[model samples]
Target: MSDLSGIWVAIVTPFHNDATHSVDHAALRRLVQHLRQAEVTGLVALGSTGEAAALDDAEQDAVLDTVLDAAQGLPVIGGLAGNHVGHLHARLAHLNTLPLHAVLSPAPYYVRPSQAALVHHFQDLAERSHAPLVLYDIPYRTGVAMDLHTILTLAEHPHITGIKDCGGSLDKTQQLIADGRLQVLAGEDAQIFHNLCLGGAGAITAAAQTCPEGFMKMYGALREGQLKEARQWQHLLSPLIRALYAEPNPSVVKAVLANQGLVTTISRAPHLAASEEARRAATQVLDRVLREARHIGPESNR
Candidate 1:
């Protein structure tokens, strides 16, 4: 097992034409290659950005394979998400045979469980998982928040490694960092610098999917102690973030990648594609950020 101890991306799954859920292996390779050139530390495959929930198990496996192959040597994290312990267990079992660094699981959604139930779920998963576990605490989607208390307890499990916290609450993040039980990775692209301030390791950003050079520069600026520069970059990227998420996720992000000629302009149906208007908005934002780059990043990384 390897470490997921820095900025990583919950990659949007690139698709083959026909606008289906099938993996476009060549495009997937290019996306992963882009991350390498941009210097992201790792990748979370089949996560929400990848629309893992919408894919069947076989499709999810194919995506993971493509991700692992494209990753070269960087760590690959498989998203094995569900409300059912049985389904999660079966997924983990299938993954036990792979070379993934870890498996990420968000607790059951729609029906919010008590902290005790959440604890039990992680305990059961931690006990069986061959790789280390990453707790995903995106309450917006899961309708369940794995608070620091529950997470601190889970961290005691040998299999529990760290977290991908999208709850967007700094107080909860500080508590976990203060408690020293788990490492917290920033799940928001817009707040990478702020998270790094509170002992956060780095980001798992949506924007990084399309603008990795800009994203890695955010981290580089912070790491190199250029807080003023990092702050400027954060403020500059704010427009892009707003535009990218102005509509549904993956769609806008995938569309941005497609514009950059990195990925397909395709996504599963019922999931909307970015309209020309949305693309125009995002382009304007990216343009402003690029023009303002000298005020944001390290000269070398720039």
Candidate 2:
């Protein structure tokens, strides 16, 4: 909706028992407040860190619905990623009934599809969804790398509003920006500054779920032509990102939040909870980040 610019957060779907198989609405409401106070531009519910794969269809709808309801004015993009195009279409159909800005769909995963197939899948999705669509290209997660030529090809569709490029290849990202008119947002938490410098849009980083203010500070500094400060802040966040992700993502992040008294540190099956040492490390990093983040002013994204 608002051109999908600036810092968008791929929010973690907080769970009660470290099992994201179900979402805790109260925790989500708290998260919504954090994101809003942090002044993040958008919210992506049930994204990777959200552990969408571990949840059911009902869980997905509930998560999206609750976040949109809690956000009030903030734009909410339904995170509708699955390995099957058919299932994605179904989910998009469901989200169409809600008040959302767009459909944040990750590229189809497993048994790698060709770029031609990918283009078709996305175009088909665009045609079917009530909301605009943003493509998510994270080859690491999907195990299928999308070439620049193919990305440019998909961007040609007017219905395709933007993309969350998580491939971690700056050269490829640069080429896409150079060749297309697509709104390109960085998906990797570590590349927000570099992405803006390379002419890309903002970030929908998972880490932003907790460090929205700090990330926005880096974004603000970069936008003001202050790379020196931007780099400094980014350096400060680098360790936090690494340590939080040392375990299976939301697991560690959730645990850190729980320790900090924000939400329950829960994860579903296939993902384990963080170790005590990891929890301690994550907490230490989070405390320092929260302190430094305060200097940025949008209130800590607790």
Candidate 3:
């Protein structure tokens, strides 16, 4: 199985500020390069933060392609989620052709399959997929929760190697870590430190996009048994994380990135831009975090 460990950022899909609102390939590349410089463990393309639900097949393909090319050898996990099995299989077939590290899939949204059905669904996808499968268990968005038993059973599959855990159950999280089978990644940004301290692999974090260096420093500190250092970084990053999710995801994230001149603050229909309040909050927190990170000096980060 692939070592699905460390900070993997679920990147946002940058769109042009135009009437068409087309994918901004150049800006996307820039964002990828920026993350790369921070030395993140990997990149998750088209995950929820990427606004995958809003993009069509062609647009998804284009976005994935852009991410792969600009990733420049960073392991990339393509996001896959849908209710239609046949369509999902077809999408998996295409993903198989690409050089993806893994495919991040969730329980079928809206359909809310039974636990048994969830197992079968993931088993089938794992069998069909060329790359390993990282189960994305976000009950809130998918409207269906995977019981702990369900996840443990799925772990029996060779291709089912890890989980992006947003189930909101600390007990389940601890059990998964203790099981010593699947690699557990904290799906929620706020839980990153908690998850890591419990022996989770790392995080598939959207918040890291705004401050990868701090996230990396936290991870590094924890790994090196520097609890105090890690805690300091976590404290610095918490407010920004909360602010990024103060509105719907990727809005404040885009707003912050826009301030950095990496991407525009434009979202598709039904998803509005971040409020000025959210923008101001994120900006303030981000500035303080960056300022403190600098004050601590590069030696501490290392």
On TM-score, the leading prediction is 3
Model 3: per-residue Cα lDDT over 186-281, one tens digit each: 999999999999999999999999999999989998998888788888888998899899999989999999999999999887799999999999
List the candidates' TM-scores in order: 0.93, 0.92, 0.98
Model 2 per-residue lDDT at 253: 82
Q: Which residue pairs in candidate 2 collide?
A: 18-266, 18-267, 19-267, 20-268
Predictions in order: lDDT = 0.81, 0.81, 0.94
Q: Give the worst 10-residue stretch by lDDT in candidate 2.
A: 293-302
Cα lDDT over the full model 1:
0.81
Clashing pairs in 3: none
Candidate 1 C-alpha lDDT tens digits along 221-269: 7787887777777777788988998888888888888888988878887
TM-score of 1: 0.93
Which is better, 1 or 2, measured by TM-score? Answer: 1
